[model samples]
Target: MSDRHMICPPKHVAIIMDGNGRWAKARGLPRSMGHRKGVEAVRETVRAAGDLGISYLTLYAFSSENWSRPEAEVNDLMGLLKAFIRRDLAELHRENVRIRIIGDRTNLRGDIMPLLLEAEETTRNNTGITLLIAFNYGARDEMVRAMRRLAAEVAAGTMSPDDITPARVSASLDTSGIPDPDLILRTSGEERLSNFLLWQAAYSELMFLPELWPDFTRETLIHAIERFQRRERRFGGVTAPSLAVGS
Candidate 1:
């Protein structure tokens, strides 16, 4: 496929930015250093997606289970996040990219929460591309939290339990208005989902790369996009139209 054309261009792309700690350890560097470098990769990937005409890009920045790491490391990661947003948010806005943070806000520090909100509000009107950061997120947790809210509303008679459905639950999710991922990429050769977006990735094409998060580049993204374009998405039922002969 050429840079101007692809076989299966995904409108939404989600990525699991993994292997930062391992990448750092291999180089005898602090984990924070790996995270700092990972930010550069984020910038590269976002620019590549925008250039490829992708409408939505989601990054698994932090997971709910990540709290199990050392307190110092967690603090450092949070600091890196704050710095990334503060420094890059303006440039991203100028590029017409909308920023949105998804995950459990209750676990975030009050001070950090405000910064996240500000980032989202700052680029809410942009129409070019959306950058979704999955911080302190877990797909299972999101589903559970949505269900709990629905249950509470039903208990209070403000909503009916019978009215609860997939659409309602989806609307309650942090990514309510956004479409589910069409392509999912994981770096560091990891094959697991890691509870990133279990429900949203039902039909997404999965691609695993051996490169660490910080090592990803525009070329890597282009290769992945090209590979994705070659696949035929049947979405269950009959075969793809491309496979139909004599049509």
Candidate 2:
């Protein structure tokens, strides 16, 4: 590690991988090809995260809104996801990396659900970096689901509305055990959260890059972290006295 990387690394990092269709369009290739290449980016980013000593890495793989796409495209995405898990699960497990899926799994296709469950179950005891794939996820939907859990408890007389603190609500979330991402990054130069980790990104440093997902590299990851380390995160508090002139 160089002195450049000696800065404190964030405990959790999340990425919104975007622009697959655009990448394919620009390359005159099928969108499916872009998605396949994006999978390669995913593998590289995961390895980069581990090398950077990040404890949790969350990837916005598939959103609930993504189901609205054409059936063929959706199937292609599903197939790619399955291929990734089946091909890489063993290697990831051997690396002592724990796999976690954070999203709505209740309505997943029969074939996809088992693979996700198996991935999690297989590496449940690993004591290393956690890779959280957010498939079928939308931040609003996540919050809604978390709210429903609390509401059900209230209805059952196990809790009251007044007891619903931020901490309590967080515990009801799908990412209950995971820390909030300290850095949230998006690709393709898009500057939007796009319903990813809204609840969990209260204080995350956001970064947007111009590179398409398929073109992402470890160098991009390093550059982002270098930028992240230069930020002075106060988390909505004053860390020191104001030094502004004429204050």
Candidate 3:
């Protein structure tokens, strides 16, 4: 591919890893197998993002709505999460990747909380690309939580309703301190956000690819980066005069 996009790589790239079940169904395999394969894709994508110089890579691993899935599948997912951290945490740490978990952690499974904390604590000081895992996360819930915090503050006389600016609201969310994603991608040809990063994705370049999560590779990521580089992010404003159509 072209080296031009490499010169100006996006600082953050977020992905909604979709179509694991469909992928498995297409091959007449158990859905669990698709999730396992998706984990492999996660590993490769993490490594690739670092190599590509992307500063932050946020992955939508589990959504709050995922709780409604079958008990067996939920258990399988929990097991896979535990296994991934146990098996890959050290290598991720060694590579200087900083692990950050977003979403509501207050109600996570009994055995899962410690592992997630360990992953974050272990990599807290790393200076490399931040790998954010969006587990049990929903954008609307994030907003509600943030709003409650502000409302409480206002009611308690700490601040007025006027203090509820966009910046304050943003800082109160789970992704506080992290910049918004430059590109939001979903595989399986899905065009919707599915409640992923609604607030943060306001100006992101949306990309939908036909590949399932299990089929994602470094090359796929590179192509997404190239696509992002080609976008004209006006951010609700006009472009600079130098590039005007009739200039």
- TM-score of each predicted structure versus truth: 0.91, 0.95, 0.95
lDDT of 3 by residue, 149-190 (tens): 999999999999998999999999999999999999999997
Score residue 199 of candidate 1 by CA lDDT. Answer: 83
- Higher lDDT: candidate 1 or 2? 2
Error of 3 at 185 (Å): 0.3
lDDT per model vs. reference: 0.89, 0.92, 0.94
lDDT of each residue in 70-153, candidate 1, tens digit only = 999989988888898899889999999999999999857747889989999999999988999998899999999988989999
Report residue 221 deviation for candidate 2 (angstroms).
0.4
Supply every candidate's count of residue pairs whose N, Cα or C atoms clash at under 3 angstroms.
1, 0, 0
Model 2, range 114-227, lDDT digits (tens) per residue?
999999999999998999999999999999999999999999999989999999988989999899999999999999999999999999999999999999998888888889
Show where candidate 1 strays beyond 4 Å: 1-8, 240-247
Q: Between the candidate structures 1 and 2, which one is better when assessed by TM-score?
A: 2
